[model samples]
Target chain A: MMHLPNHWPYIAAAYGLTIGCSLVLGIGAALRLRRAKTRLAAVESQLRHRESSAS
Target chain B: MRPTPYLLHRYANPGQFLRLARALQPWLSTGAIIFLTVGIVWGLFFAPADWQQGETVRIMYVHVPMAWLASSCYLGLAICGLLSLVWRHPLADLAAIEIGPVGACAAALCLITGSLWGQPMWGTWWVWDARLTSVLVLFFLYLGHIALIRAFDEPARGQRAAAILALAGAIDLPIIKFSVQWWNTLHQPDSITLTGAPTMSMTMLWPLLITTIGFTLGVAAVIFARLSAAIHESRTRQLMARSRLNRSDRSAA
Candidate 1:
């Protein structure tokens, strides 16, 4: 494993890409989940209010 | 009920699906992060430099996984589309929709990483070789699915049209896989499946395997999250329509 006159750049590229892709995926999931939770809560509340009025 | 391998019945109802998604979210996110972190570190630092390719081979760690996910996500979308078309399952339609944008993103990642890898190894930024061209077509396939899904006034019509397109695009899967064999190109054939033995050592194999699993799980986790949002949005729309109908009836009374 002695082939490193200019190997670090490749390593950096690989690492940077791995981290960047993971970040995008993780953050995107979190934001979507948050938005879903909010919408679900709002709908649930609306349904509850409608049920109470009907009763 | 026991947690099955595929969790097939857990999604039988929208409510059940929502519950399972909420329960799985944390574990999926954690698994994605941990695997990616370990895989990248191992590949970048510990994997021995290739005897022939030197450090440029490190790009394989990123490029390979993205390519795999790009192709695989389309399959996922196609399967979802089939389920939706056959069963008229709203959840299945939501899944196809949810997976489309993410699949497109994965395709873009594949393209960018492949270009980066190519620049160092192949001496060019862009090439229209069989492998590259097929992957490019896969990207366009994904874009077409996404655009078609959003083009119609009726959401169900859009979903139906998109579903048809996705099933038709399944033809490209084999074409992409066999392009290197059918054409003489700069792109290498499947390293993992090619020849009698893998050309790389154990150190390289471990990281590649780990990264592939990581990327796949990461895509699934994101898709699940997106699906949850889509379900909520659809439900809200239905409830609003029902409420409007109720109001009109009450006024008529």
Candidate 2:
């Protein structure tokens, strides 16, 4: 196995930052999508209820 | 055969785009995770250390791809801006808006990682080099877009203003690309070239390429997911407004 360099901390920091930022952005986008879908569903269901009562 | 206007219109429709995004999201997100895992492992452990830079070379894996996406995303935003302005394509505006935050995030990553890499190599954490400065500008442009988009009372007006800003900011892309060649800078020139073979060896090159592909897929997935959310939000607002109108009409009757 190749020996790890003394500068391993730098390597770890770089990867950590990259992965950290990526996870934040990815999770944030997912949450936004979920919220939007929930809102849309609620609005749609209310519309359906109104239409049925009107009929 | 060229796509007809009807085909373009159909593809640009939010409902059609949402359907396409739903179909592609799973595959894109999964592929991004797989490729990123494989590439990062290979880059960090298996790839040979640079003879000069030693272990610090590992920073290139993340920094390079982030830098690539930072610029590429802006290019995409500019194209979407043009489409929105000239063709009045609502989907283009939506894409531009969604891309702003993602591109800014990528650009910010690039700067941070670049600084980390530079401190050990260049003996300084930051510099006013053309390449670095232009990237900073790119990040600010993204922030400007995000701020402009939310600045107006009417969303349509905000979109129009942001689209114009996106188009104007595109002038920075080429400057960022050719900065090293054009200026005397501590930053090195491009390792990968369009017209000739890459300067990097295969072991280093392969991981970089794989990581780039993974990052690209990840960016695409995020953009699509955000676009879907934006479309849904727009639809919900429209529905709420219509419902209010209907209620007022019934009361009047």
Candidate 3:
């Protein structure tokens, strides 16, 4: 099509790969943090309960 | 203390870092999104095609930024290495752990995107030239950092070893930068240099700059989030271990 530029496929592929990879990595970091925080909160509360019960 | 030392000492603790990172993370991530969107849209649609490479030159928007991030991230890793060794900055090891994987991602993206650009422009999918090889080596170094950081069951041992590796791998930074100039290579010399003006036109330069800023902020946001999580996880582990010890003592009694 006249609308499309030269080497459009390569351009598209390059952008696709870059954006896709960035999104995956970014999302992965967020999820890891979320999981870590959740576990930490649970453990902290448990320990607090243990301490209070012992006292 | 001097201003520099005052600030470093003030913020050296993990608690201070977490507070700062938490406050800054949203702004950095938002800026990354805004800048990246504008840069990409401007680059892909508004910018003129190159006289030499035509439309494929657009790939430079992403490729160039990835290249920059990969190298700069390595520099950051080296700084973490130094901090870990010199002061045993508590955040340094955790920072390195978070950065290693992200740097690896950036480096891998750099290599792949470079290949894509090279294929159409240079008529090859791959080359073993200095610039290319050095980047490949950089990528491997990132992987090696990841492996070493987790290789030991004791987290301190692993973090310390990775710190040393980061410091040593820093020697490659200069080599990568000078590869084109030092030896014959398919890769072109840098168009942009600290002492010289950019060889590129303003239109192309603007988008590239914006996208680069966005990418840098994005990296920071990710690292901050990862660091905060690592700290939380660490604190919980310590408490849990103490709790377990208490439980064992009571059971023995």
- Compose the digit string of candidate 3's lDDT tens values, residues A1-55: 2343358878888899999988887888889889988998899888888889999
- Ranking of predictions according to DockQ: 2, 3, 1
State model 1's lDDT. Answer: 0.81
lDDT of 3 by residue, B41-160 (tens): 999999998888889889999999999999999999999999888987878888899899899999998888888888888989899999999999999999999999999989899988
Candidate 1 is scored at a TM of 0.89
Give Cα distance to truth, residue B40, candidate 1, Å: 0.7
Q: Is candidate 1 or candidate 2 better by DockQ?
A: 2
lDDT of 2 by residue, B47-144 (tens): 99988888899899999999999999999999888888888887998898899989999999999999998888888989999999999999999999
Greater TM-score among 1 and 2 belongs to: 2
Query: Hey, what RMSD does candidate 1 come out at?
Result: 3.2
Instruction: Extract clashing residue pairs from model 1.
Output: none
DockQ of each: 0.52, 0.68, 0.65
Candidate achieving higher lDDT, 1 or 2: 2
Better of 2 and 3 by TM-score: 2
For residues B98-197, what per-residue lDDT tens digits would candidate 1 score against the true structure? 7887888778878887777777677787899988888899999999999999999998999999999999998888888899899998998777775567
